[model samples]
Target chain A: MKWALSLCLLLSVGLIFTPNTLHALPEESGKAELWLTKMSTAFSELNFRGLVVYGDGDHWESLEYRQTQHKGTHLSRTQYLSGIPRTQVRSGNELFCIHSGDHIAGLTPDVFKPLNRDLASKLTTILASYEVGVFSNIERIAANDAVFITLTPKSDDRYAYQLWLERTTGLPLKADLLDIKGDVLQRFQFAELELNVTTPISMFSSSESGHALRLKPTPDRVSSSEASWWPAWLPSGFALQGYNKVSGSEGRQGERLTFSDGLSSFTVFVDHVENDLGPDLTRRWHATSATVRHTRSNTGDFRISVVGELPSVTVSKIAESVTLVDQLASR
Target chain B: MTDRKNESLSALCDGECDELEVRRVLNQFSSDPDLREQWRRYHLLGSIMREEPVSSIDLSEGIMQALDGEPMDEVPARSQTPVETSVAHTAADNKRSRSQWLMSGAVAASVTLAVLVGARFAYDPSALDGSMSGAALVMNDSQSAMESEAISAITVAANEPVVEPLTVANADISAEELRKAQEVLSQYVLEHENEAINANEQGLPTFVRVANFGADNKTAVRKD
Candidate 1:
């Protein structure tokens, strides 16, 4: 009888204290912070497989890609669903753009200024820059319960974010890429995700799987003492990352210049105009994120194309302000 | 007794009283200072409840000092029992799990919509070229299509000088070979342009051109 009375007393005490303990707001805040930290950590460290949709302008395409980061090496395989089926295999900085009629070998610079580290560290910036607090209760994501963390953009330069990360693995199950107007510009979601699965080496194909034209060793591949000849009035935070001089089919030389603004990059091309006249007068769309600008000088007509996830104004500005320094004088 | 009425008056501060009760309370407070004191007491209790942190609120030093004066220190100290906390947590966890299930379904539906729409607009380059002007170069009467083709092909390969009318080779090569050679050179130029764009480097190097083949000498100028 004495033990039963004591147990009853303990149960009442527990019931009374439970509400008081649950009412503490700091504990809830701590839980949210932990969830965000875990989500960021997995993005960089984990190997992920999923289908992604990429779009620019009106051109949108769905693709299946797998990204693996192991032993400090990053590899990806991209398969396109368009005509003359193509597959792009990338390991580290190298990519093979494979196709039936043609295959092109490509290289992107190291220290890809955009998304500097992995996706994980980028999320930390999201938490820091925004007043990150749960706007409501837990939300559903990709058939799993996820905390819907909506980050309102404080500035007009960038977009807002609505991230849905998994409750278990803390991986981003789905993400909505938004524009300034809060409209969904693009969407990258995991239709299916497997974490830490045994991946086959054969899953990665050599870029040479398609018919390859015997590529001549391009003149741009040949090193020259003539890099400093051309310079640009690059925007603040932009850096010259690479230089390649390709000879045109007519055996004329063309210059490819790469610049990056810590996160995003733009490519600028300077070629001797093969046509007798200048480039087209009107602006037109090539792809979603690509804009081409043409200018003429006494030397030759120049074609400047700026491509990236940037405002078109930014690209056009970069293209127009470019000035070529005389190689002989610079040397 | 006046304080009891003032306690009711305190409830009146929250605009909780209905219209009839509000009139009654207003009439009663006007005549009683003792009722006013009760009203003050009621206001004080109401403020304290509002001040209780619901979510991560920082307690001011004064508030902490007031809390220090309370006799509930022993109760808060005992509040952190792991087993008891976990019991409340299980219920909350169940709620969260349901929410996750709902969110996942929404995400799957949204992703399917995005993918199906995205697949419709694959890049088609030929379809994109809407502006075709009269840009093709016109050939002179002295230049036959075969000779012109051969000259363009040579120019495409090594930026070599265009073949002059006077320097036409008597060597027999099929017209089909000449056309094939021209196509190969055109493709090379396009590929080279793509490479330069991707590399984002220097300008295209100078190619050799014949310039003006003099009517008398027909000399080729090897310009850099």
Candidate 2:
């Protein structure tokens, strides 16, 4: 009778503790998701300016980053302070590169836009591939108390990310992109920041030298039905985000397909080549990898290149997996 | 599947098959659903054994269906006769086979290299930050030399142009060819960065990349 009573008491403790332990994980992850949502909101709604230091491997540079929310329009200007003289101003979906006092305008849709209004829904999809976590300890960044968060990839196809977001404003004060090996591939940290700073309207205006070149907006989505070439395989979570046909000099025609898994992305370019380009070559620029392969189809020789901030092996696999539509039709 | 076919599949999974065996397995894989399932299972099992993350979702069925919907031309049968072929045809065949061999070798080498690099990084104390630190931090001093050696090995294996900043691959190409490739890659990188600016709410980080690239390009030009 005494042993039975002790067993019952033990069972009660296990039942009570098990529920709390299970609930703890979800609660922590929920808090991380909420912080991400708030960070996304603050990006567009909040106005701030600061000096940022960006580095990758041995390369490092300082830049002045300014953004303002003016009349529901997001305007941002970035100027390099430590390196070559260059300035860029972004207004809505348009980006102007000011070099030598001339503005080269290009339509970069959603360049500085807020995360999709349906971010709550999209976060579910992101969480499927990444394990989002909020560190319990607080950290100081740019003189502000910050909440550290990590978005680690579930697979080796993508790199990992760490962010230190300001506690009060939820603004990311420091960000780091870590490789699969956990090395810091790239980092962006604010050195000094000021919130709610008013900027002159002229700062966002185009240079007095006027626009030297204006580029047309890329066609948003060239449907799969219209695509002549497509990748036979992609990293699990990646989805086709954009597709467009491009014409290069000498009448070379090419198609560009962009794939993204919410946080990471890669682009495959298939171009008609006049001659064979020998063996496949792989290149790495900091975190980005570019792999090129030459393939022959019934129609002609084609050059396929996969470029992205991914591992070289992943990029090479993507390049090799590109299949010609006509070739597939005839297989 | 026959016992012989099963043996071939296993050999292929181990990457020990010759060209003819690979071709045979691939042909069978296209037609036999059972073989496809077995292949998937073998891969899943291998991944599990290697301690790699494996996703339960399989999209191969949908991919196969999509391919089946396409209008396929009947494959021509191999002729027994030693018929004369055009020089171009023979050269193309040789090139295709060589390319396939190179690709296969590269994939194998890269997979092994990735495992080595990953293992090294996994145990390196410096890889983890203060928040991630625990028992790993205790071994930092002892492992510093190993970490440096591993990093150098990775750099060499990746063929990173540590000497020439902002240059593309250090292949045996003319300076002009290298320049052209660099310009094209830069443009692609910039375009990709623009598209992914807001990906995962990473607008500022992506912008920083653009700015960095711009500065590097200018510096490269100045040096040249």
Candidate 3:
């Protein structure tokens, strides 16, 4: 009894100094959420110059950029670092894409269509899909200090990401997209960065502003009266965003359809004639990911191709539904 | 008997004991409560190094020396400091190796795909054949029979019955032939665009023209 009592006393004394596991601490998660919120806000409010290296598959290219925020307006200029003598300067809704080699002026109604609020929402959703975590210490980036955070995706559909954001401004210093095996599929890093610089208004003006603004011919936006005869088995989360009807030689006719998942978009083209001849085009192009599938409708023989980043099943379902409706018909 | 029970309790805390022994200790601890407190104390001793500063021995200098391989004999207080060290040091090597393993796996997959494609086309004889005409397919050039004839000759020389390589090889065809192919592709794209617009005017979707753009940003040019 005496030894038992002594053991109990010693154990109770030791219990007073025991430390808990890191998994039990709430502070690390707090740090992750705080860092991401600051990053999102800073991207919209801060003016920072940094190199953006965009890559897909084996191709890689770098762009030099300058951005300035004044009052409520943001202006940006970008020049390709590679072979092309091209420069893009944007001010609000206007974008001037200049090709120095051809002396051609490329004009667009809205240069930075990606700066919309919907894009922000999409990015928020994308980030939330990952396990948010931080590294142990900060690292220097382009002469400025930055903090690194690792985000591991919970699903296979998306890739993991490691981002280094500026410690002071929350601007992204570098980003790497890693596959399931943790190999980097793509990387975007800043070669140089200038934070909070005073940019002149003239910097936003394109050198080709005096030249003619050549507008690419807008596509005809007309839907076929035959859309009513189509079926309705589109994939979940896919919404019809656009459609048009076209008439070609020998009365070769088709209707094109567009779909969007609120972020990534795709298109489907359904060509038909009042004959038994099946679709002549049944192939796919890597440049567009357009998969052609042919089917027969009571009114005509149709050739359909689904084009987008989505799975082939989604495209197939949408392609199966090309109906024909009279102009004045009601349900 | 009491010492043996405490030893078992410690083993349970370390996750070395069987479930039956764990249950027995848990039951006894639940009734007495003090044994449970003792088990936690032993684990804490091993974990506390993660959080607190050491006081009695020069364990920190020992750790620093172990990490950086510098002798800390110059420190005068080595004898007085108590060591408060963490077991996490032992696990660092395991974590680093696991991350490296994952990185290598991903690289292997991508690299294998690249190598296979490269090797398959490395000795493409079509590009070297003189009769094989090359065209910059994106330019609006006319596709004459000579370009077709050149493609056939090259295909025959390569002895590959597949026509897929022919299409790919034609991408580098002469500027004029490339112009014609670009016109064909552009016409196809415009046809689809026209269809989308017509559908939209009738209250349908209008977002089809630029929907599926791959990394290839090449556009078909029609020169007058």
Fnat: each model in turn: 0.00, 0.05, 0.00
Candidate 3 residues B72-163, lDDT tens each? 45534534223332112111123443453333333323322222222222223343243321122211223223223222221122201111
Best by lDDT, which number?
2
- Which runs of model 1 end up more than 4 angstroms from their true locations? A1-44, A53-60, A67-76, A79-99, A104-138, A144-171, A205-236, A279-298, A325-331, B1-224
| TM-score for the A chain of candidate 1 | 0.59
**Chain B alone, model 2: TM-score?**
0.27
lDDT of candidate 2 over B27-135, digit per residue (tens): 6766998887566544332222222333333323322232234222332322322111111111012343335333333333333333223323333445545333222
Worst 10 residues of 3 chain A by lDDT: A104-113
TM-score of every prediction relative to native: 0.42, 0.56, 0.45
Candidate 2 lDDT, A1-331, residue by residue in tens: 9999999999999887552213223237878888888887777677888766554534334567788988878888876543335677778765566655221112222222223333444576678888887765466655567776778889888788777788888887777677765566665666557888998878988785423222234345536777889888788888777776665435666777888776777988787766535345577776778777778877788778888878878888888789977766787
Candidate 1 lDDT tens digits, A49-156: 654333321222344556677568666666653223457666665455565432322211111112223434345544444444443334443335565555544444
lDDT of 3 by residue, A1-331 (tens): 9999999999998776443222232237667766766666666666767554443223334566777776677677776643344567756544456663332111111212212223444455444455677765556655557777766655443345566777987676666555455544444555456788777878778784322222122333434344644435554444555665655335555565666443335666665534332222222221223344445655656555565533334444555554444422443
Residue-level lDDT for B49 in candidate 3: 12
DockQ of 2: 0.03
Cα displacement (Å) at residue B224, model 3: 12
